[model samples]
Target: MIRRAMVLAAGRGTRLAPLTDTTPKPLLPVAGRPLLEHILEFLHAGGIREVVINLHHLGHAIEERLGDGRRFGLRIQYSWEDPILDTGGGIKRAEPLLGGEPFVVVNGDSLLELHLEDVVAFHRARGALATMVVRPDPEAARYGLIELDAEDRVRRVVGLPPGVEGTFRGFMFPGLHVFEPDIFGWMEPDAAYSVIRTTYVKLLAAGMSVYGFLTPARWVNIDTPRALAAADLTLRTAPFRF
Candidate 1:
């Protein structure tokens, strides 16, 4: 079982503006609890005992609120990025804490309700370099399209439509992933980079083992103020069904 995980909480929540100016995105409240708390609840239930959260914009607030993480049933560590390294760089910085094994990663801003154990199993069963958690999003065109083959291995990712219909369908990634320790070898240590633009895309181009685990679970990205509002309503009415 994977005991360690990474929470990508470092991004400057520029889309949320003045609200995020004073608060980190992960600390924003959803359904009366801090967003990070919800993530911790999920992680704890998923059997993750330790987590490393990457910090950047308004990071102090996160540290102040979640300091030590004992109260949340997990041993928490922080990876401070001086210049706010992107996704790839952030993960690379926390390599020492994540340990030498396959680990789970979740986007702190997104509320994800999936079978966490199954995701880990699926990743290892296929021996994939990286396994992305994806869901059906009608607005897939609005985000990077995750194209899959008949076997559900992520074959290609594109910003524009393929313009040709095939056995593949596009979906939106809900900020959840599983990765092997060796996946770091493809990255440049301490260099600012995007896992999407720099790593995953390159791996796919090289025909490496990048797969997608499709889940029908409820997942919402409280990215913008409007999204947060909608998520609050949805969450309050139904609660996360994990």
Candidate 2:
């Protein structure tokens, strides 16, 4: 069972400048509550007992607000970054806390209505090295894209080839995944690596089963002010609650 998770909150929200100036993007309020709080609540409700959150820019504020996991009914651990190790490094740093088991990793800034239990079950069922929660979209080029085979195993990443076309319908990653402990073996030690650029792509090259779970639910990547505002508005009117 995937009972632990890691929230990647270490990035400097360069795009969301003015708002991120005072508060980190993860702490930014969405629907009256901080985005990270909603993620914690979701994990707690999903029966996850432990969570490790990595913080870098304006991290003290997050540490002050969420000192421990007890307040949210979960054990909260902080992976304090000194030089702002990127996504891959951050996850590598927290692997000790995550232990030798497969765990869930979510971007603390992005908000999505994830079926945590269902996704976990699916991850174990498929026996993938990593299972990405992705959605089919026409605007696939704007973001990192995943190409899945007939069995839904991620065959190749979309961007590496210069003139890649829609061989298979591409999907935008929702910033959430279930990863096995072996996934870290593909990463280089002490280097700034992205799960997509370095790890996931390597898994595909090694012929590992990397699946994509297409979610029909709503997902928003809150990077810019306009996107954040739209997400807030959507969450308000949406029938489902995160």
Candidate 3:
């Protein structure tokens, strides 16, 4: 079972600026609780006992609030990034802390209502190297879409995959994934790059088992102030499912 997870919390949250000027975006309040706290609570219920949260841009606030994570029933560890290492680099740096097994990775600012165990089970059953949690975004332009073949294998991500038939499938990546430790072999250590552009896209082109597990529930990406406000209102009404 995948009991370890990583939260990509190193971002500066420039999109949600000013408020993030004093607090890390993940630490921002959602329904009276910090977003990260809600995520941790969900992770705990999902059977994840250990978690790694990468920090930067007012990282101290997160460190101070979460502490060693005993209060949250988690063994929390921090990966401090001096000059915020983008998604790929952040995960690469935290490789040691994540151990040598497959693990879950979620964006700290995301609020997803889905079954984590099911996602892990799907990953194991398919023997997939990496699996992303995606949702149908018919307007594919803004978020870029990931297309899957009949076998549910990702045939294309944004652009076309090598030697594929006519038009490929497409869907939006919603900031959640199950990744095997071997997936890190595709990333560059200590360099800033996007996991999507650098790894997923490349792996798909090379015919790897990089697949997408579609979610039937709504996902909240708390990026802008308006988005955060909407998420806060939503969370107040509907309880998280994970």
**Candidate with best lDDT:** 3
Comparison by TM-score, 1 against 2, better one: 1
Instruction: Give the per-residue lDDT of model 3 (tens digit) for 128-206.
Output: 9999887887675588777877677877776754566655567788888899999888888989888887788778777
TM-score of each: 0.94, 0.93, 0.95
- Summed backbone clashes in each candidate are 0, 0, 2
Candidate 2 clash figure, as a count: 0
Listing every candidate in turn, what is its Cα RMSD in Å to the true structure after a full C-alpha superposition? 2.2, 2.1, 1.4
Worst 10 residues of 1 by lDDT: 157-166
Model 1: per-residue Cα lDDT over 1-242, one tens digit each: 88889999999999998899898999999889788898998888888999999998989899999999999889999999989889988999898988588888888899787768889899889999999998888987677888888898887776422243457878888888899988888878978988877788778767789899998889777799999998888888988855
In model 3, which runs have C-alpha deviations exceeding 4 angstroms?
A: 160-165
Model 1 score (lDDT): 0.86
Which residues of candidate 2, in runs, are more than 4 Å off?
Answer: 160-167
Q: Between candidates 1 and 3, which one is better according to lDDT?
A: 3
Q: Scored by CA lDDT, what does every candidate get?
A: 0.86, 0.82, 0.87
Candidate with best TM-score: 3
TM-score of 1: 0.94
